[model samples]
Target chain A: MTPFDFFILSGLLFAVGLFGVIVRRNVISLFFSLELLLNSANVLLVAFSRLHGNLFGEVFVFFVLAVAAAEAAVGLAIVVALYRYRKSVNTEDFSTLRW
Target chain B: MREVFFYLFAFLSVVFAVVSVTHRNVIKGGLSLLASFVALGAVYFTAGAEFIGIVQVIVYGGAIVVLYLFTLMTMDLKNFGKEPLRTISLAAGGAISLFLLFSILYAGYRFYGGSIPATVSGAKELALPLFYRFLLPFEVVSVLLLVATVGAVAVGRREE
Candidate 1:
């Protein structure tokens, strides 16, 4: 009901997503975590938009949603292509790009 | 009643997200994530962002997660191999995220007792700002989607 409750929700989701991002080895799970991160931000945005009594933040959420979709498309394409080449989705296997 | 539903859905979403993150089966994890998103849409609805709630269900629950699941279908899941948990990394990730969570809560402490105004943001109300004020960004997002589509196709295409 309060903005603080929303802050708690967003923060917990963000924390969970960050942990997944750091600990997960699979590209697919990483993407899931990334999406969660984006969603957490969206939650806060919607909350703040309600707080300010304006639609600007809601409008911005639309852009974020669009960008998230594009990111998912491009990132998944790269992961799938990489899987074709290497036959593995593990992060350790894709370290050829690492210095 | 609204606040009750809001908290219920919010709690459910967070629980589902944790399950999604920690689940061993990727398909099951994706399903859990879908449930989480749907629950979040309910949260949005309770908060009075009706259009956003619907769009969240459609775009996130319907489109994005399904795209992930479809991409998953093309791969052999049996060969995913188990990830060995490293204690050091586990501790690090846990510590860092916990720190972040505390800091975020601290930052928002002043807003703890404050309630947001009751405002219903249906599509009709949302359109005025989106189509009028943010028209340029709207068009740019369209172009961005187009570019992403092209780039994905080019990258995923196999050489003859």
Candidate 2:
């Protein structure tokens, strides 16, 4: 496959993830979108690494994976805490800090 | 052969990702996300990133999605309430993402003809650079993971 094919896949994934991030009100679904966004980046990174004939991009994917995991863990924790305080997962209800 | 599999998996991943994004039920959305991630891993495998592909499935499909599912169990889903479809945000999100998609395609257009070289990046092939050249960053990531774990526990813990 050509690099452009990978670009198409990555771009579509990013767009879909961005749509989800904007439209979805649920925090968990937001996280799902966030994961998609990260995955899209990973796809491009792997493709570029392959194109360059080096292992650096693949190695960097590991770091991205680790950061994604950490973000998921910490973000989920914050969501849970917010849910406990507010009794809702909908973003509109999270207006306590609103000016 | 590889190109066929790459296109197939790429199609599957994008389809599942769209489903994950649009589905109303959070649990179902997460499950579709899992499928999307696995399909993406297959795409990686087709691209010859075997180790990254396997790790993608194990980490994203197995760990992250499951963690989201568990967190869902803690919330009252019945009270999630009706999400009013505002025309403004829908238009905005659609417009922005469409623009971004086109921009990305345009950016990658110059790279159209090049094909990825034939090289299998399995764990063994990847370890040399990962362990030797990028060793410091690897250690930093480990530390970051540890700190994240502790922070998650601290934030999620119940009060005394």
Candidate 3:
């Protein structure tokens, strides 16, 4: 497959994630979409790393993975805490201070 | 053979990503997301990034998804009622995403840069620069993970 093919794959994934972020109401599903976005970026990064003949992009993916793990942990923690207070995971229920 | 597998796994990843995001059930979405991640890992493998692919499966497919599942288990899924789809928002999302997809593809098509060499980079090849040049970032990521762990525990802790 060509590097351009890789771009297509990554772009489509990013679009799907973007659509999900805009459309999904559940907090968990939104998180799922966010992961999709990150994964897509990883895909493109790996592809470019391949194109450039270096390991830098692969190494960057490692950092991205690290950040994703941390984000998931903290984000889920916040989700659980929010659930405790709101009893709902819907985005609409999250508007406590809308002016 | 490599190209075939790449296309296959890439197609699977994208399909499963769509399914995972658009599924009506959150659990199903999560499961599909796991599948999508695995497929993406296979894509990486096809590209000869063995270490990153393995790490993808281990960390993303294994650790992160499980963490999400457990966290989800703690919540009352029955309480997360369905949200009605807004036509206007759906249209907007579709339009915006189409614009992004088209622009990205156009840019990629226009790219005439250098192609990748045949050499596949493994963990060993990656370690040299990672330890020497990128050492600070490596150390900082560990610290970031540590801080995140503590923050999660603190934030998710039940009040007395």
The candidate that achieves the highest TM-score relative to the unseen native structure: 1
In candidate 1, residue B62 scores what lDDT? 91
User: Candidate 1 at residue A41, lDDT?
Assistant: 94
Off by over 4 Å in 3: B112-116
lDDT of 2 by residue, A40-72 (tens): 999999999999989899998999999999999
True contacts kept of each: 0.78, 0.88, 0.79
Native-vs-model 1 lDDT?
0.95
Question: Taking the candidates in order, what DockQ does each have?
Answer: 0.88, 0.90, 0.77
Q: Is the docking of candidate 1 incorrect, acceptable, medium or high quality?
A: high
Alpha-carbon deviation at B138 in model 1, angstroms: 0.6
TM-score-based ranking, best first?
1, 2, 3
Among all windows of 10 consecutive residues in model 1 chain A, the one with the lowest summed lDDT is A53-62
RMSD of 1: 0.6
Give the DockQ of candidate 1: 0.88
lDDT of 3 by residue, A1-99 (tens): 778888899999999999999998888999999999999899989988888777789889999999999999999999999999989999899887887
Candidate 2 residue-wise lDDT, B1-160, digit = tens: 9999999999999999999999988889989999999999999999999999999999998999999998888788998877888888899899999999999999999998978887898989999999999999999999999999999999999878
Kindly indicate the candidate among 2 and 3 with the higher TM-score: 2
Q: Kindly state the number of residue pairs that clash in model 1.
A: 0
Better of 1 and 2 by lDDT: 1
Instruction: Write down the TM-score for model 1.
Output: 0.99
